[model samples]
Target chain A: MNEVKKLPLQEAANCLTPALRLAVDRLPEQTARAAEELRLRVGQPPALSYGGQETALQTAAVTAADLREIVARAARDSVHSYADSLRQGFLTLSGGHRIGICGTAKVENGNFEGVRQFGALNIRIAKPVFGCARGVYEQCCRGEPSSLVVLSPPGRGKTTLLRDLIRCAAASGARVGVADERGELAALRDGAPQFDLGGPADVLELCGKQDAVMHLIKTMSPRIVALDEITSAKDAAAVGYAANCGVEIFATAHALGLEDFRRRTVYRPLLSIFQYAVEIALEEGERICRVHPLKEGAPC
Target chain B: MLKLLGAILIIGASGALGLSARQGLRMRIAAIDSFLKALSRIESEITYRLTPCDELIALLAGENDPYAAPVFQDMAERLTHNDGLSLSYKWSRALREAGPACGLREEELGILCDAGSFLGRYDSEQQRHSLRLTAARLSAVRDEAAEDLKTKGGLYRACGLTLGILAVIVLL
Candidate 1:
């Protein structure tokens, strides 16, 4: 490897891979049966829907030997310490759960920046809650073009809703391409997905959301592309680009109430392309829903 | 009779001295053993990180595509961060040996010896296999850190005990 590429940032990822991969491989097999049993036999609180999934227990096996290997690996790369990994980002094995991530800040444009340094990752040990998204499928997909914008005040079932809706759309013969950026939406069962998303609806996971969206649009010509969170302007632009191509979009966002969603319309740089903009926002604990006929000069 | 009594006293004294020396040797051995175990484990991890990078390089080189060369930036960070404790153990061992060879062979042992930015450059992966490498790296880190702490803790105690026993023998 060249010197520039063989840099600190490069080594950082190299240092983290082994543990995560082992966890990924073992997580499914190990946690599959136990986590399934736990989700079923565990508490069924009304507020909490047991997505019937297991927690990853890989970190549970993180012995002293594993740690030493990490240190040793770092040491080999000329790194004197490991604490600095947190300043950037670190894959937290949340007791065998794997959450891979990039650093909080980089020397980008010869400057350092990002949100309050997000160096910790939570690998949401994904479980196939067979009926997890069944609750929100209809709400997300009931439209002519099905231009949905699922909103939740964080920690809500937006992704699950999106996942189920993809299945719903696919089942209905709509070609869906899910930009599963974090392996959350489709929760790839082993190598394949549990949900029968028709005719290999391409799931561009781990690939950047915007890039994946663009790729799917150009190549697949998907009838529907289920995007997770429309956070960045780039993502908005991609969605808008996809919509311009005449393909419907099934997307989600983060918002509190209808008014908040209305406010978010300003962020609808790309959202204006969709003829129908169905906003599903959460107010208090309940979801106060609305389906808007989006047109030219309308409140996006 | 007096000569016999003197011999017996001397024998008793020698026996006590021998026991103390044996105890001291045991302590030192324990210390060295713990230190070596930590060092060896940390050493093993260098191979862990390098293997994937090499494999990634090998795979990409054959294809003549940089993009195709997989990356594991996240995993490298996890391995280096939690596993930095191994440094102190290695340092401790070096102190005992009082030599450069004992300290660290940077070329021979691929330990990114400086804990400064252990997790430097694992950006992302092009394939699923790289993810598996990431999994292994994280595990090595978690295991090493916990092990280092336990071993170092025990080793330190042993060193102190050995010194204390030596001091007692010398003073008394």
Candidate 2:
């Protein structure tokens, strides 16, 4: 597979207010490229997060208007259209960058209406490191598709790995079905995926993960099914059912390692479904993927 | 023969002036009616489809309202090819520029500018509320314009003809 190009940080900065955008632009080219997330809070200077550290942009404190402008721009001046996603506290931009919102919740009878009086925004820039999954793919999915789970605590490139793995699987003549619940993995626009997930892959975007999994399994008849962040019992049940039907699963979970993953009661049921787990860690700003075999009934 | 020609010219010019005044009133009424229709369509789109401001403006531009359609088209073009400006700015600017040609009064234009401020800055319910309020105000303005056309239209025509006849009689 050809190398996938990295999206520039300026693409994410375009969503910021003019002042914040200028502050980010003033950063050194290397720092801007290495940046992962842009953080904005009301009455605070904007900051950039990279290498598990945050560097504040020295400028005027972010105002309520600045935050609102970011939200307005991110929604493309259509706040009503993104009401559902805003209620869930995030809006996915065109290039797959996710903007996490913080504000007063407008709840009606215990149901979330949406957000109001915006407070802060975390714009997580999506840097799709295309070949980052090479080591995991070679170890876990060489000859035949394998059911493997990517383990990481947050921001350790779990989603990035799953995206590349899906691409790798699809390139190898396998029909891969992606359950992109948050519209993050595929970032589909006009029926075309923004991120290259290979030609043979089919994406079901903006649907719940469990329904997407079952729906893909039933309709697409995919050889491999991929999902990001399996966080619920329903999702585990769906993954288990898909595995039972002889379809390989590639998924990610929030865990430090296999032992930490096994300790979580909610994800205990999923352990039996995955044959191997890949744990991602950052050492001196370089990502290291450690693949471990999960023998059923193996001691923790 | 020269006196006859002069009298005819006086009457004809006065009559034309009356007709022009009546036409201006009619045009105002028509412009108000078109704006009312456009506002109603906007409310429906917001309440039901939750269409984005740019897309909604583009849709309105495609409509056949002679007065409002051009303004909507200008706003749509600006929105489509945005240059990092806010929607409120684009919206107000478009209306301020094209609104006079639509025969909209300053008060009516003010209402439209106010509506632009909140066009896409809130959720569906808030947006619909703002649209409905703008429509209500425009509707009142339209009713007044229609009443003016009804009451003063024939009076202007008659006064113009009477003035022309008086001028001819004095000349003779």
Q: Which model scores highest in DockQ? A: 2
Model 2: pairs clashing at backbone N, Cα or C within 3 Å: none
Off by over 4 Å in 1: A1-121, A131-145, A187-199, A269-271, A275-300, B1-172
DockQ of predicted model 2: 0.79
Best by TM-score: 2
Q: Cα miss at B48, model 1 (Å)?
A: 16
TM-score of 1: 0.43
Query: Per-residue CA lDDT of candidate 1, range A1-300, in tens?
Result: 665532212222333336533443443433333331111111121011123333433243433334334433432433222223322333222121223333245555875422122333322333333444444455444544356677666656676566666776776677888886655565453256544455647887556777898888878878888888878777788787777778778887777744576676555564456544545555674644455655564333
Query: How close is each model in CA RMSD to the real structure?
Result: 17.1, 3.3
What's model 1's interface RMSD, roughly to a tenth of an angstrom? Answer: 10.0
- Per-residue accuracy of model 2 over A1-300 as CA lDDT, tens digit each: 997553467888777777788888788989988888888899888888987898888899999888888888888888888876777778877677888888887889988766787888899888788888877887887688889999999888899999999989988899999999877788875467878898899999878887898899889999999999988888788788889889999999999888899999889988778888999987887789988888664322
- Model 1 Cα displacement at B88 (Å)? 18
